[model samples]
Target: MNDNIKSFLSVLALVAVGASATLWWHDMMELRWESRRTMSEAARKDRMLAATRLLQQNGRVVNSVGSLGELIVPKVGGGTMILSGASGTALPGQAEEMLDWVRRGNTLIAEPRSLTSAEKAALAALDPSSEENDDEIEDEEEEVEEPKPAAAPASAQGKDEDKPKDDEDEEEDEEEDHTPPEPPARSYFTAVASDNKDPLTDRFGARVRRDAKACECRTEPAEEDKDKPEAIAAARRERDKTVSRLILPGKSYPLELDGGKMELVGLPNAVAPLWSDDDGGAVRVYREGKGQVVLVTNDYFSNYMLDERDHAQLLLALTELTPGRHVTIVRNLNVLPWYKALWRNYSLFLISLAGGVALMFWAAVRRFGPIIPAPKAERRSLLEHIDASGAWLWKADGGRQVLLEAAREDTLALIRRRAPALFRLPETQLWATLARDCSLPKADVSEALQQDAASHVTRFTRQIRTLQELRNHYER
Candidate 1:
């Protein structure tokens, strides 16, 4: 089966491989922390360790979960991110605008999946047990119940007396406004195509890397976690279309022409925009003058080594070469040129690439060679016949006649226009000379000068027919 139809089978195999890789990589990318709480100290340490490992590798990796203080510390400690999560240092401040950091240049390289077993186990250990919450239960036991029959009925009037008149008056109005309402957020967003058609994408290309980052939003809970349900809700398997665009500063990325707009802020040099199909995750970046984001419908970047998933390696490789270059990857990585791959045993791809080059050469043959189509005995249409006849006549400066009668009429017209003294000679002899000299019938010549068709009966069907008739009638 492997050898029988290698080329045909290659097409099927390659297509299946591409689809499988796309889908598999997406699922691998779907591996994201589901927790909304801040990362537990351990998870943070794990992230730091991972970052430290990358730093130790003396190269780099794009940490999508790059929002932790632990992770950012490496960059701060000589590892530099395009943006920070810490306040005042260009990170989204830990205060109310935490998500705003994501608006800046940040891609959160987070832990895979929600709370790790270690984190959950640690949380379980640290959680207040029933015994630990005993004080709270006892405190609840002393609840201020409805005027109960525990002789507390005797205290009803006293309780009413305890209610202060000023306090009651303070609760009078629900309509009283204490603070101003916050401004409504802009609802529209633009989608910049990853096709690199926009001018602002000039900085992005394959091979560019940035020690840039994302909002340090933690997945583990603090004492309380509010983003949990929302996190689970995010996993509701629905397609999210609210993706922000990548653009330069001050350039308005308009989602709708009515001017509902967004600004392209800071983006990591490593985190260039790539078109991933159906990835539902988001990577938000915000800078002082620009804010750009690329959300995923599915995870296209895999967590494994490049050897494991070529597509992910391509993502990394693409970002590396992506700087200031216009790259169009026309083929998939069904195989690579690495030294250890068994698939490289077959040189069919090389053969195919060579085939493509041969095709190009074949295509070029037309541009350099003669342009006229090879002649064949195909029937010509009437319109084509007229054009061909005109072209033939143009190439040769001969008779204007299409038939013998036209030649006769043309001679008569010329004679009429000249009206030389020759036309004043004997009419029959003049006609005979015209017939002999110009290959027009004597009868046809007279017919042409006459106002009516019935004057002379000979008709010219072809040039030769007129010439023959004229020759037979003339003495010469």
Candidate 2:
């Protein structure tokens, strides 16, 4: 084959291999990321197999009744409306709806990459209760009977005398009432892919960090005498103690979508990604009721918290907040349609793939086409062409002898014609007249009479240039 054909075939073979490999690579990556590369139909059936289990575990299909029933209400277990690859603000007004659920003692298990302001506010508004240590010593357990205060100080035999001075007695009774601190308002039990110090951490434990700021608990206990009978009744003020719990799933949350873009436009200065000992930041909101926005840079209520290590703690938090009514929402890939997935789940891969295709196409079109031959330009030998070197000027007119003799006769005839009566003149006279007329410099007229072969060729070229130059001069 010609070189062009050979190269084109080689490139075509390469491209075919590349295209096949590209499709294969795409399928492989899709399998890895989207969880659909296997026998997809079978997997779908498997996820759906649990439908009956869902109905049995959670109450019933509430959605069949027109309302998504309660996404926020956590049951001993609950059914979920699982969604996948939700991009941008996936569930609009979901935050406000979630807040309403929180108020109704329901739970919202959101799996959005980045939580919205309204969503966060909904969570905060619910104020899910923190999980309390069920094993804590309660009033019944820590009673410490102590034999009814040892029958009251025996020196108190006279009841009339032992009575406290009017106002003092009344104040002592007031101070003696022992009441446990009021339980905190109900809050939310969120699942995030990331965790830092601040509201997201265990607020009762060690000092958690929030974006370089440390949040340590500082409790101010109620002031009450410990010694008196009424003193036991005296309540200690709840401590503002540092409560810290490292949210598992240590991955940074997608503040916006699966790519980690944040949803809320403005993040408060108080809340940061993580906290260190030096951090003094707090999480707060201060907008003029722009739909009650809540901004959380971290993902605390995402699917990443479902790891076995974290499941219990997350479940406990859920129970603490809403007790019997907590719902867990997860993003399930099987439920999504195939065509719509690339943009939502594999956007980066798709973009890079498009670029790769364009590059390969350009490389093929430019490097693998036929070779076209260049035009064969007419060539000329510079010196010979310029001088008409090899041409025979003598033969071009007539052969040597004929041309010479004809020139001699033409010149004689011309002389006779010009001289009028010279036709009858002697040979000697004719010859002399021809010589005289040759004195004129017109090469055309003079060349017609030349007889030498070599001289004719030389004179013909020279004669042509000279006569043409004269004619050009006359014309100009």
Candidate 3:
């Protein structure tokens, strides 16, 4: 190909590469935007964060805690506290303690199930008329009771005597008998406007209205109703139809509220109803000592519901009831994992423990000095074998005699090799000649050459030494 053709091909290749890079950059930007949107949605899972922020924005010092134990009670001029996400039941002995805290001039706002037996007792103490009414009913019942004998005589003629004597009495009896039986008690309650004045509800001139019977209030279906599809459909319809609204004098705003199903019953006369419904009170406030307790059955201040209607306004109103600037919100009673709690509370201790463990492990596995090369193998000397053999023979039975005989033979062989003329001589002459040649005593030479075994250790050792000396002198 010519230079022009090559240049044209190179330009086309560069253009293709640039177009591909542009497309890839656009796709990457799209993916980054999509991922950020997903993360933003996931970050909003906390249902109370919005409420906390609202309180902070309104100049209130807000603190969030998981349980009541973490609550910090103010020393003087007590603060307001909102307790949520807990069943109304108090742990053993917690009710009395909590009530005592409330009596110290703190305002407590919580659900119905959060109320303890001690609090109920305090409410009952506030209303003595209920007990009086019960007593009067008992007295009337006792007065209507008659003797058994008198009642039996009346029953004998009751068939005809039971008839009313006058039309007015008959109409009265019919009215009494035909009165519709009181509706069965329900487990749930709704929110409605109360006739009584309240500082919390008076600001907005509005109240949250909810359905009397909605599926959201019932956590589970009844055993008999579970099998009925019609019952299920009706409950779903009611749930769908349930539309809560903040109703003012002329205008109203749509609201969505999540509330507990527990009914607030046995309220004292001293409790000022902020909002109520046909079944029971939805919100109430009462005084104990210098403190006030505000009961809220519905959780309308949640993150999802805070911006709806006037829910946030109601929260601000509740906060205004207290003089203190601090507001503590107990969102849940969940216990944190041990590790997370340790890290949160005793971070220094956990860090120190981790550092100590790491140091210990390092110390255990650390090398102290340079590596030493392995020693080279060496052959044993002849003297070492002889010493080892002597040790083994010394430990054996009759080994001393055998050693003496071996030494005598070895001495004679040395003499014969060095001086064969001395061996040809008679025994006594040979010994004298060997002694003269060796420069050792004649008696030592004869004893060394003798075949007799030494009895004691001292004698045996001496004979072996003499034999070794004669052999050494002749070898030299």
Candidate 4:
């Protein structure tokens, strides 16, 4: 092969082998855990499909389980909802479509973390602000409210005894009346996104701060009530509820519904506060044409949280928000990740890979290898090797043995070619059949075929040549 082509082929082979190894390793890891869980399987607690079953029983879920663009194209109708958990990270191309779906009145319940830049931009446009215009309008409105004249000082107001306060008392009264306003409470949240002028964030008043590490929350029974028997029985009943025995991630906080009313079931978290004291995370509802956009800081109503606290109640409430609600839960994967595809059908992938490598090898060798002229014959004549070996054997005193073996092989070959059925007979019967077929005397035929019995090379050669002549004459 040519150097360049050979080098390319070598590199290609190395890359294919490396890629195959990587896919094998990934497949092993996937098998090490479990098969990828579908949304319908309820037993997959780790992957959280329990919530899917709950939704299936309660609501009308759409068949929008593919890419995001599929659902957004027709602009999902109002009263229909799209549900997503933390796994529903939108692919890059899906951003615009998702924005349209939400803006067109479809409810999208997703983690703030999954919002793409395009989706965020669409969110920001939901409630566009005019800070400069608002400021100018406020400045214009304030000009009409002129301050009323202050009361006259005590010295000038001798006629009114009730207004006879000293200058020191008047200053003290002004100080008490004009209490300084409390500064705006510090935001315990960081922007879910990096947009400084993000209108959606401003409207919501807060978003989940990504910097806060997730804390594990284990639910335990509340303390017993000793004073009242009724209270103690109630406490015991409350402690036996399913929510008290589960372990859940505390990163999800309750969303306060103001513009929209919130529906929840089950008792509130009685343990230490799960969220920062200052970070009463925000929720905002924006009206877009006939539809509304409800944004929340966290996707707490998900499968992972369904069994913990009121998450199942929260999800049920979402679907039951309006009767006849159609909900579509978007379980997202990457936009056709190649490795995932390969791992999914590894046998086919391996076969294709091997075929490709073989083709590449063939092409490389064909293009790059030196060309040689074709030989005269495909195979040398049969007698050439026999003659060569026979000469050596004769010099080594094994010529008679070679002659005997050759004579026997020649006789078997002739009998196999003609009167083939007789070849399977005993030696004596085969000899008689051969003699009868060749129209020769039995004694002469026997003497000719037994030429191998001669011990000397001269006798053997003479007998072999005689038998050959006799066979040639009989065949003619």
lDDT of 2 by residue, 229-272 (tens): 55444222112122123322343421111111122221223333
Compared to the true structure, candidate 4 yields what TM-score?
0.31
**Model 2 Cα RMSD, 1 decimal:** 30.7
- Candidate 3 accuracy as TM-score: 0.37
Which lDDT values do the candidates have, in the order given? 0.36, 0.37, 0.60, 0.49
lDDT of 4 at 298: 43
Which candidate has the highest TM-score of all? 3
- Tell me how candidate 4 scores on lDDT: 0.49
Candidate 2 TM-score to native: 0.21
The number of the candidate with the highest lDDT is 3
User: Model 2 clash tally?
Assistant: 51
Candidate 3 residue-wise lDDT, 165-203, digit = tens: 686578778998988864432222211112122333232
Kindly give the stretch of ten consecutive residues in candidate 2 with the minimal lDDT sum: 207-216
lDDT (tens digit, per residue) of candidate 1 on 277-301: 2211223221222333232212233
Residue pairs in clash, model 4: 1-368, 2-368
Question: Better model by TM-score, 1 or 3?
Answer: 3
